[model samples]
Target chain A: MPRHELLTGNEAVAHAVAMAKADVIGIYPITPQTTIIEEICNLAANKTFSPKIVHVESEHSAMATIIGAAFTGVRTFTATSSQGLALMHELLHWAAGGRLPIVLANVNRAMAPGWSIWTDQNDSLSQRDTGWMQFYCESAQEVLDTIFLAYRVSEQVLIPSMVVLDAFVLSHTSEPVEIPDNETINKFLPNFTPSFKLDIDNPCSFGALLRPQFYQEVRHKLNDAMSEALIKINESDKLWKQLTGREWGIVTEYRADDADYLFVTSATTASTAKPVIDKLRKEGLKIGLIKIRVFRPFPFEQVKKYLTKCKRAIIFDRNISYGHHGIFAQEIKSALYGVKNSPEILCYTGGLGGKDITPQLIEETIIKGTKTKLNGSLFEWI
Target chain B: MPIKSYEVRFHGRGGQGVVIVSKIIGYAAFLNKSYIQCFPEFGVERRGAPVKAFLRISNQQIFIRSSIEKPDCIVVLDPMLLSQHDTLAGASSDCLLIINSRTADLQIQKSFNNICVVNASDIAVQNGLGTATTPIVNTAIAGAFAQATEIIQMKHLEKAILKYSPAKIQENVKAAYQAYNTVSKPIPLK
Candidate 1:
């Protein structure tokens, strides 16, 4: 029987990893992400979980250790946040390029020059091209569920996955989560048995240097694998829903059916935007919200499907690309390029450094967006 | 009818178990079969440094995941934080204020209409929850919170304290009940 427990987002991740029966976990402690490993240690100390917990000196080594462990045909996991994530950038590509099916929980903290430990998307968004699929979660339950879904998809597609939650908003937030039973979890995720791995008896070279003769083809095959990952993710999501009676869509469309104005955002901001949309709707505003759950796959088709008929789309991005637009805004603009009668998109950047995104602030942004004229520039700082 | 929700912000020094207070309340609400979300204000915390934690309890699922801006109730584990001006910045006029002070100051009584003062620090010391220099008032304050707000009952809070209190479980529960019985009734603004 499924049992409910009051767990913080970090605790939920630890529970999921333990329940998944991961063979190894490599972790380097960082703010917001530290409690995850700490909880795992507690579970291990209680003799309830028995995975080999590697206490690495740095985030770079943590990712590298997990990659090596996963190559031995075993389930592996790790977690980090902000500066810790930046330190793992090189190995992020290494893990993906080496095709290791490792799952990482990234607590989204602001990248610091002034030294902030608050929530933001820039840290994770900076790793956009690392070839790892990313899912931004809205709640502790979603964070826990996405870990399982990520593992299922990553193992099937032979790619790594990163599950993101806001630093304090969800990472430290405690909420009730219905933990799936061992019987159901085992049914959903059997032991990881990779077709190709570092086997002593089969002695085959892995990640050897390749000349220009077939390097492009290797990259092409990786690209094709990403495409296959999309299908696998959907299939995994359906199976998880069937097993658990819950499903978080790749991109959740909230009351977007007949609205002319749509609000586009991700993570906790999307959670806050819903009530604002509801309040506006009560006052006769035809506005809706679209939460981008899966950021890696981009969900281009799903995004276009929802915004094609709307008159305008307002995007709130908690991250800014210094010389360019907000990362999500840029991806959305590209996703809507050349689409027939697409909504006029406006991007507003705010909530960086973990600033509060209150319902009033969201309403103010909507009111400002409704009055703005597109003068060849569609960006503003809220 | 829409489900009712209550947002609470807790103010205390770092070693006072400020974050744990919010968790205790969340656990109590969970035991009552209500939904809850609790989180601390992320920062570099040190002993004696002021810290804040937040909680939201609702009869239905809470979709919004943001810091509490205008809290419906405020719990002050340290009386000194009340001296800081911003402690009650976003609270509404009718907001419930529960402070861990041995005696209610006139200034606080003049400023807030709904205020309750409890000697949680003294009670905690008597119960041996922490040393006198840094008495852990979280459990005691939680008990006062239950008596004042009625958001949760004494029975649920006792169970939560027993389940979550780190050490001296019976002492902590005794501290909570003592505070619950001894906490001063709310005094209207003068």
Candidate 2:
């Protein structure tokens, strides 16, 4: 029997971690993401879940602790946001290169020049080169399912996975979610099996500095693993859907068939676009939405297959790259570079600092982007 | 399509955990086999900033994705948030407005057709809870909500509370019962 529960996106992540039977959690509280650790602590206190809760001094220490825990062959997890994620930047690279399958929930918040605690995609997007597989969720239910899938994908590919949700917009927002049955989840995800561990009997060097000859090889191996991860991620997602009856893959397409115009976005922004898509479809507009659930590994093949055939596209990003344009938009446009008959991609940056992106705004932006005659100058604030 | 959804909005400050109040309500409805959705809207104000959380409950899947523009019920967790903006916007003429305030002025009383006032902070403090942050008001409000419409049974709320809450469940039950009895019905202004 399915159980319905009202849970914030943060709480949903914590619940999924508990369901995954994580052995150790190294967490430090940060805004928007703080409730995740709080819920975990409360669960620990109530003996609802028996995971070890290690309170660290800072996000840096939190990441280090998870790394150590993962190295010791234990299922490990943590949550952080914005500056906290920035603090864990170095360890993020370490976790990936060390090949520890640690799972992290990053509540996306804007970086500070003005000390803001609102939602944005920059915090996680800025870490695009860190080698961590990223999944951006569209709803609380997706947050729960993605975290469970993250563990499977990370362990299978030996790459750390970060599940990103908008800070206050999704993290603090509550929604009705179907908490999967324990047996179903268990049947879907078996007990985690670490590929390598630090054992006293079998002593091996980890993170050792290499000479130039070996350094290139080590990086090549990391790049190979990233390439392999793309396949593993899709495979795991496919298996997960078969087991749980929830579909989550590299990207989710909404009414893309016969679509002349496409609007691309991720996270909660995708949820905001659904109603607008329905309204536009009724008004005889051949429009559609493409939600990019997986950020790392780019999903370029799928993007080209699904969106390149459209007449035009609009890339709406909640994060900016300062001097240029939306980070993901720039990346998507680059992915299609030199491809013949590729859709004209326009970029719109909105929802920064937690601004609400209503359905009206999404409709207006799509209508304007599809009709605009300008090429690169279609960037407008909604 | 049948329209059977009930939307409730709660207004409060950032530190007050007003969002949790809506979650509890939605959970209780879920326990009764209803579909529900709850979410919070917050500004940049850190500690003392005003915040709002909205809830929608029905027997079928809810399709509305926007905030509660027209609320059937409005709960004011902090009376101070009421002073900042017009709380009556999108409020139905027959809406039940519950405010956590000490004042009983006629002007405030005349703002709505159905009003209920309770000093939930006082009850929370009296119960030895440190701050009225989130107050014991959620429980009281839950009781009043039940009494107002009887959409959910008292037993359903009890089960939901036991499942979700760990501390001060007994006190909360007491607060709920107290509020059920003390809340006065809205009277027309003279």
Candidate 3:
């Protein structure tokens, strides 16, 4: 029988890493993401697990350490948020380009200007082109499951993966998590067999500087590998469901079928949308929610299939793309640009800087966006 | 079912380690093979800003994901939070209320069958642990909690502290015992 326990999203990540038997964990303390490292360190100290816990000085060092460990065929893990993740941006690309399958838990916090520690998707969204697979988890249980599955997807496709959760929203919130038994998790995620390793004995060169002539082809190959990763993501999700009896696809559709309007979001925002959707459904609103679980390699085909049927769609983003609009909104619009009968998509941005997006706000935005017909760009900032 | 679950909420500021205190309680229960869950809630508030932590422990699984609207026990790390927010909003008549306050004359409007008032800060200071922070009060509060309901034994709390705490094991254990003696039960409002 599956054992059910209550765990915070951050603690769930720690538990997941322990279950995966990650050889090394490189982490630094940052808001929301801090408890994850703290718990992992505590676990290591208590001898609950024997993973080598390295307390790096900064998020940059944390990312670099994980990259180095992953290259040497060690299943490594790390975590960060907002400014922390932003600091690790350069190494994030390096980890991906080198095809090192590292798993990171990014507790999503808003990027600063006014200094916000609240939940937002901007940090991870900004690194969309970094070639790392990103999974935005909606609950504590999802956080656990996604971390386990991240290793599978990354190791199989040789692409690093990040499991993103809201800063304090999901990160600190404890919920009932049915933790899969060790044997079950072990069966689902086999010991990470490296596709390639830096062997000093064999004298193989890794990440040698590429000249301009060969750089494009190398970049092209990396992009092609990412495309191939999309298939592995689906396979991993399927395998996870079979083992754990929990169904999680790249994009989770909630009442999207036969709907006139759609709301797109990720992470804890999906939970916030549930009550709003429930209220709207009672008022005869044919609206639905589409949660983007997997943000990287952008599930364009699946998004197109569901979104193309809706008459109007509103992209609700917790993260802003500066002068333009919501990052996810922009990406969704780009995905549907060539599709026939694409929904009239609108962008609604709020909940930045830790501001709460209540059910009333969601309901009001949907009603306003659906009622109005704008000229030129359909995107409007809420 | 026979009996459902018990929910306890802790109120304090950001730096006071409210979440960690609740986690200790939850972890102790979990170690005893009880179903347990604990979490913290904070806004844009920085250090010293008011924060809250919630815990639910039961014999069976707990499904409620929302905040503890009706808490069986309310543990207040700071007495000021009681006046600043509705810390006792959904407390039942039988609900046990524990507060770490300096004001001896402070009173609750609603008459609860069980309540505990302790000057945990004073106890902590007397014990040579600087500041009446969450760590000092947490063990004391846990002791008071154990005394009030006996939900978790004093030995279980001591075991948990010894297990998780590395340096301040002896001081924390002393504080827990001190709290068990000092905390006053809820008295009916005249």
* Chain A: TM-score in each model: 0.98, 0.97, 0.97
* Cα deviation of B103, candidate 2, in Å: 8.0
Tally clashes: model 2.
0
**CAPRI band of model 2?**
acceptable
Q: What is the interface RMSD, in angstroms, for predicted model 2?
A: 3.2
What's the distance in Å from true for residue A58, model 2? 2.0
Q: What share of the true interface contacts does each candidate keep?
A: 0.79, 0.43, 0.23
Candidate 2 lDDT over A310-379, as tens digits, reads 9888889988988888887887887788887788788999989777777777888998897889745456
Candidate 1: tens digits of C-alpha lDDT, residues B87-137: 887887788899898776535522667888899989999999898888989
Which stretches of candidate 3 lie above 4 Å from their native place? A376-382, B1-9, B13-17, B20-38, B43-50, B54-80, B85-190
State the weakest 10-residue window (summed lDDT) of model 1 chain A.
A369-378
Report clash pairs, candidate 3. B115-B186
| Model 1 clashing residue pairs (backbone) | none
Q: State interface RMSD in Å for all models.
A: 1.9, 3.2, 5.6
lDDT of 3 by residue, A202-320 (tens): 66678998999999998898888788888988887787788878867888888888889898887777766776776787889999999888888888898999899898888888878
| Residue A22 of model 1, lDDT score | 85
Predicted structure with the largest DockQ when compared to the true one:
1
Alpha carbon lDDT of residue A227, candidate 1?
Answer: 83
TM-score of every candidate: 0.97, 0.88, 0.80
